[model samples]
Target: MSVWAAVLALIIERVWGYPDRVYRILSHPVVWMGWVIGKGDETFNKPDETSFETGRLVGAVCLGAFLALVLVVTQPVARLFSALPGGWVFEAAVASSFLAQKSLGEAVARVAAALREGPIEAAREAVSHIVGRDTAGLDEAEISRAAIETLAENASDGVVAPLFYLVLFGLPGIAVYKAINTADSMIGHTSDRYRAFGWAAAKLDDVANFIPARLTALLIALAARWIPGAVPGGALRTARRDSIRHASPNAGWPEAALAGALGFGLGGPRAYKGEVLDLPAMGDGRRELDADDIDRALTLYRRLLDVLLGATVACAVVVWVV
Candidate 1:
């Protein structure tokens, strides 16, 4: 099952790639579904004296329900669509929709372009898409730094993690992972409202992403060596050491590698809403970050895409021959 999923995913990526219109159409359903689920969770998200065990139980139930829906409901629906004259096309569309190779690059590139054109204002706008920071007062350097950090983190979350699950368990796995990730993003936090109940979602997401995030960092480091001006040697060392420094056990690896590759630092002192929180920095040395650094980061991002695509092909070949 895993091997077939990998082959199908690679075939879809190579043949159709990710057309913007296709993504727009497919993402609409996921986004709307996410919004509806998010609203329901919010409504039921009252602060109660729930035990940690209860929270874990609730999370388990929720996850089980999601899996059942995807396997029993969604897969049948996909097969129904596949029964059409061009059913395989619909299946490919569904598979491609879940993958984020193109979307990630385009999102990061937009930020880089925005920064290049308008400096601080451009950066402020771009930062909103990528980071959870107060961008209104951030200078050019801060905005660029935030964008780079987002690029690295999302490389794992948005791209590699989903693909990893898809390869392991097919569309059902990807759907469940996305649902859990969405739940975490919406309610998984240490705040008073979610500190207890959201623990399962947060912890599960952490577990799911653990290996993928580290793999993403290694791929990024390899990409740095391939790019013209990136410092792969230092980037590799910094990624290993600083990956555990950031508040997130997983996010730090990629961000630290990206920071070191570009000769800048990231992940220190961010403002959420209006409150400032002091966070540990990712890279060893601090250098001034600017639009040019963002460009370099994008270069590395593109290379990472290539690396991932090549890996997928290799995996597919191995599966086919075996």
Candidate 2:
């Protein structure tokens, strides 16, 4: 099943590629669904115990229903889209929607562009989409640091992880993973209301991403040597040493590897929703993050994407031939 899925995905990637229009359309449905479901929590959310428990119950049921709807809906939608005039075009659109290469690049590029246009404040605002940290009052280096960290982290979570699941189980797998991840992002935290209720969602996402995160780190390490001034051996060694230090057991691996590969440190103390959390750093380098570092991280991410695509193709061919 995995091999077959990989083969099909590879074909779509090579022939079709991702299209912006497809993403725009898909986003409408997915985001609207999330909004409708998420709004219930916002409306019912209250300081009282009864409201908290009720919100949790509603959230859980909504998430489950959403997941089921996506699974049921995507097949027909994909089939209908597949029937469009140009076969290659439709295939490319499907592949592109599934792939995050373009989206990730554009996201990071927007932050860089914002920084260029204005200042750290601009960069902070632009980067908030990709990161969870508080952005207010961040210095230039801090803003750059956040963007680079987000670039590296999303390269794993937003790109490689989805592709890994797509190759393993097709669109349903990818959709399911996205739903779970979205749910985690919505409520998974150590907050007063979510500590117990969100535990299951957080843990499930952790387990789902475990192998993919490490795989992404390995690819980043391999691609790092191509980056000028990067010490290949040192980067890999540091990645191994530092990946486990972050709060998340899975997120640290890729983020640490990218930090080491780019010869910078990431994942330090930052504020979150008025709370100051002392997060562990990811690499042993000095804190010298800058716009150039963001560019370098982007370069590394592009290379990693190419490596992943090539590997997927090879695996597909091997499976098909065998």
Best by lDDT: 1
Error of 1 at 48 (Å): 4.6
Name the lDDT of candidate 1: 0.74
User: What value does the lDDT take at residue 41 in candidate 1?
Assistant: 58
Total clashes, candidate 1? Answer: 0
Steric collisions counted per model: 0, 2
lDDT of 2 by residue, 149-209 (tens): 8777777777788778777765667767777777688767778766645555677789888
Model 2, runs deviating above 4 Å: 1-29, 39-47, 50-62, 75-92
Q: Clashes in model 2: which pairs?
A: 16-92, 18-96
By TM-score, who's the top model here?
Answer: 1
